[model samples]
Target chain A: MTLSPEQIIKLGDLAKLAVTEQEASTLAVQVDDVLKYIGRVNELETADSIGQWKDTVVNTNVWRADEVRAINEAERNELLASFPSREDDFAKTAPVFKR
Target chain B: MRANLTIEEVQNGLRAKEFSAVELTQWYQRQIKEKNPHLNAYLTLNEEALATASLVDKKISAGAKIGPLSGIPMAIKDVIVTQGIRTTAGSKILENYIPPYDATVVDKIKKQAGIILGKVNCDEFAMGSSNENSAFGPTRNSIAPDRVPGGSSGGSAVAVAADLCTYSLGTDTGGSVRQPAAFCGVVGLKPTYGRCSRYGLIAMASSFDQPGVLAKTVKDAAIVLESIAGPDRLDSSAKDKPLKKWAAEIDQDVRGMRVALPKQFLEEGLNTEVEKSVRLAAEKLTRAGAKVELVDWPLLEMALAIYYIIMPAEVSANLARFDGIRYGMTVGAEDLWSHYQQTRGQLLGPEVKRRILTGTYVLSAGYYDAYYKKADLAKKRMRQLFAQQWQKYQAVLSPTTPTTAFKIGEKTTDPMAMYLSDVYTVVANIIGAPGISVPGGTDSQKLPIGWQLMSAPWREDQMLRLAAVLEKE
Candidate 1:
């Protein structure tokens, strides 16, 4: 159940986070501890029928009218203004691809 | 004199002209200024609170009819967005983010003329058990300054306990509202999932997260629930049922009702005083003609393990939205990937990062079936087990937390120790049941211990009625 430093770094990368070497080492141990605890879930006997039972307990695929509603212009502007970088009513971001 | 009034009493006072709304708001504002430095309960006070109160006062003077919550001042947890206010969700990432629209519950409160006091501090993104996880600072327990206020809704609990506001709004994913209320000596209610709209709550574990109420009394919590609970087009999960009158049902007798006390919760790791107080509270219920029976529910023991896996998995998916391009913190970098890495890595706190990492690991390619899928099936089994219990028992009773509030920094270093504090409360969230924590009694240090009562889905009326019996005792 223990995680290696490389695994921790890989997880951070997958999660879109950057982990320092120190953090990776610390998180390696902590994540291992948490995973060890969560390993108890393996002891529980789960059946294939449980998936069908889950659907009975939960409601899904709720549908609403497919009608267009105008967005509040003021609210939309406010949301746009909240972006860290904005350009002409759109959120700006760092270049996705660099040559 | 105004500081100690309950929500009902506040309404009565307003109707009787005992105090104007503006005067009441001023009292709370003054109290916050005086007490908040030590408590760290409030992160940001609403600058327009006085103006809103004045408007309520004018309406009253003009003979206009006021809503049920008219002029009652209350604070909201930082996780719930408040328009025009800096809603940080107790994270450095959202330090400067101001929401443009109100959360559905906030809008409902405003329409009822509930005066907004401020946004209270919480654990970052409502992730931690203790308020210690807050990036700002830990909120001190109102009774004992050195002891930590149980969290992630610690500030909301403290505000109500200290009479800084009539009531406060908080969110409970696991034990955020109820655990803190147990520590701070107030009433906290986590309604059935989808009872209140989640339209503006900063998402935590989306499946478990629900808006909750922390108030001075059970009736006050019920009143707030009645005010905010209903169908909303904004939150698809919100139940489309006719709203029940929760406050009106508070006085209903619980005579002859059957309640189950799960034996598992009363076993190991439980504080002796907390156990004794909860048992005494059960005795009181029995004396009042309710049948209190001890039941063995071993499936309950697996709740915390299941929660850690499933909750983090959901947290990973929900928090993936916090990239640099959107509303939160941003760091300029040469590439988009580095922008995300630098912003989140630099801005999110340690506990949050841990959760994200664990979440990603479980949902990762190799471990998905072993961890995430198994946890989901376990959750389903747990739900069915609870349903069977509900058929026999009217409600379940347990200690809200394993122990009373631990001293500050006591359990901060040990994440597992902090996670164990929620063992008793997480079941309610996993099963999507409504639960409440009532101030049962106090320990040797006079720290409050709460007795928790939970009922089947959408049965908040029954849950609150049982809580009312405890409140009367």
Candidate 2:
């Protein structure tokens, strides 16, 4: 149940987080404690697992008409105003590749 | 012995012309001004609150019929978005972001002419059990300035407890609303999941997060619930369910109602004084003519484990949308990966990152079946266990939290200990049942203890009625 530093670093990358070495080391311990605690979920008997009963948390898909309605003006402006860098109507971001 | 004004009292006072809507708004504003410096309950003051109050006053002067929440000031949890106002969810990432649209609950409150008292503080992204994790600052318990207000809805409960606002809206993912309410000595009601629309709530754990109410009375909680709870086309999960005159109907006698007190809730980790208080509260219900029995529910012990897995899983996905490309604070970098990494790493707090990493680890390629699936199976068993319990008992009761509010810095460094504070409260979210916390007797330290009642899915009426019995004593 322990999280290795490598796994923590890999998780940081997978989560798109740039953790400092200090923070990663700290997370390694904290996450290990949490993982050990949640491992107790294995205490539930395997016979009564999801194999017998279907997971009920899933809801029926929401189907709707494929139509575009007019967006509220204030809402559109507020959203556009939050962009770190904007070009016309697009939310501009950094270059995806070095090339 | 409630000190704050309830909705009915506020309504009656307005109709009697004892105080104008403007005056009421000013009163709460003054209270907030004086107390919030030490309490840190309100993060932002609504600049338009007075204007809204004046509008209500003019309508009253014109002899126009007013809405249910007319001129009643309310502080909103920072997590629930209020249009044209900044909704930060107590995180640095959303510090400067103003919501484009009102959350459905906020919209419903506004439609009824409820005065907005502005947004209250919370744990960063509602991730922590203690409000100490709020990025701006932690909110102290109004009851005991030295102790923590149980969180991540600490500010919401504090506002209502300190009478900064008549009532406030909060969200309960694990124990956010009820735990804080218990610490501050108030009524907190978390309605059935999908009862309140989640359209604009800053997502924490989409499956567990529900906008709830913290008020001076269960009746007041019902009033807010009636105003906000309904299906929304905006969130399809908010299925069409029958709304009730809960405020009006909560007064019915509990002559033959069946209630069960889970034996494990009092076994260990529960403070003896709090345990005794909960047992006494159960006795009071029995005296009120309800049949109170002890029941065995072992799976309840594993709720926090299941919640830690499922909640963070959802949090990782929900928070993925906060990349710098769209909104909030962003740090510049040459490459996209570095851009995202630096933006979130710099802006988000440690607890946020901790959960995200844990979620990433659990849902990673090889571990998904072992961790996520196991938790889901546990959750299914929790649902089945409750469904069986409901066949015999109308409500299940427990102490809202293991102990009274801890000292502010006591558990700050220990995430596991903080997570254990949610042990008794996470089951409601796991099973999607409606639950509430009412003030029980206080501990020897005089910190307030909370009594909880949970019932079947969408069966809020049963729990509300049972809470009314507890409130009666």
Q: Tens digits of per-residue lDDT for model 2 on B1-473?
A: 13477889999888888888888988888888999999999999999999999999888889999888888999999999998899899999889888777999899989878899889999999988779999999999988899999999999999999999999999999989999999999999999999989988899899898999999999999988988999998988797999988989998988899999999888888899998898899899999999999988788888899999999999999899989788788899998889999999999999999999989888988989878988888888788888888998999999999999999999988899999999999999999999899999688888999999998988898889889999985
Question: Ten residues in a row with the worst lDDT in model 1 chain B?
Answer: B1-10
lDDT of 1 by residue, B1-473 (tens): 54579999999888888999998999888999999998999999999998989999999989899988989999999999999999999999999989988999999999878899999999999999889999999999998888988999999999998888999999999989999999999999999998999999999998999999999999999999989999899999898877888899889889989999999989999999999988998998998889999999888889999999999999999999999687978888888889999999999999999999999989988999889988888888899898888899999999999999999999877898899999999999999999999998799989999999999999888888889999885
lDDT (tens digit, per residue) of candidate 1 on A1-99: 468999888899999999999999988988898999998988887665545654645556878888886878887888888989998988988888864
Q: Which candidate leads in DockQ? A: 2
DockQ of 1: 0.74
TM-score to true structure, per model: 0.98, 0.98
Candidate 2 Cα deviation (angstroms), residue A17: 0.7
